[model samples]
Target: MAGVPEGPEAEMLAPNLAYQEGFGRVFLVCAAGRTGERMRDAPRERLGDTPEQERGIVRDEPGETNRIRPARLAAVEED
Candidate 1:
């Protein structure tokens, strides 16, 4: 998962490993209000998934991510 490193021990390396192994695309979770522990744990939880499951998890995340649009962009689109 592509969580920004929030603390010193955050598990950024796992995503790089996942990418190298071709399990799925980089999982970019939104780190809006999450703590380092949660961010680190999220990717680790998915480590057990098959590639297909990983793909679905990664694919579905973006829909939730997309809902957090900027107000200015939303206003512009309305215009």
Candidate 2:
């Protein structure tokens, strides 16, 4: 039910299969290299910030520690 995929193709496919098979929520955490870069660049809505605004904020952050702080604390923090 829970394991790492054998490769990229498997990683992409597994979440869909898990969702189709009735998993309430399927999360594919690809946090390395190109995958991580793509995800970070991808637009997402948060705290009423538009995609453009979010992108700008990302660009303005000075370092990785600042960049990742919001994401790492998001689930636990109310705001």
lDDT of 2 by residue, 1-79 (tens): 4665666546555445543344233323334344643543322212245447545555554465556767868956865
Model 1, position 4: C-alpha lDDT score: 53
Candidate number achieving the greatest TM-score relative to the actual structure? 1
Per-candidate TM-score against the hidden true structure: 0.58, 0.23
- Considering every candidate listed, which one attains the maximal lDDT? 1
For candidate 1, lDDT tens digit of each residue in 1-79? 5855654544567655665466635656766578877776767667777878877767877776676657647889999
- What is the C-alpha local distance difference test score of each model? 0.67, 0.46
Question: Cα lDDT for residue 36, model 1?
Answer: 76
Clashing pairs in 1: 2-27
Model 2 worst lDDT run, 10 consecutive residues: 39-48
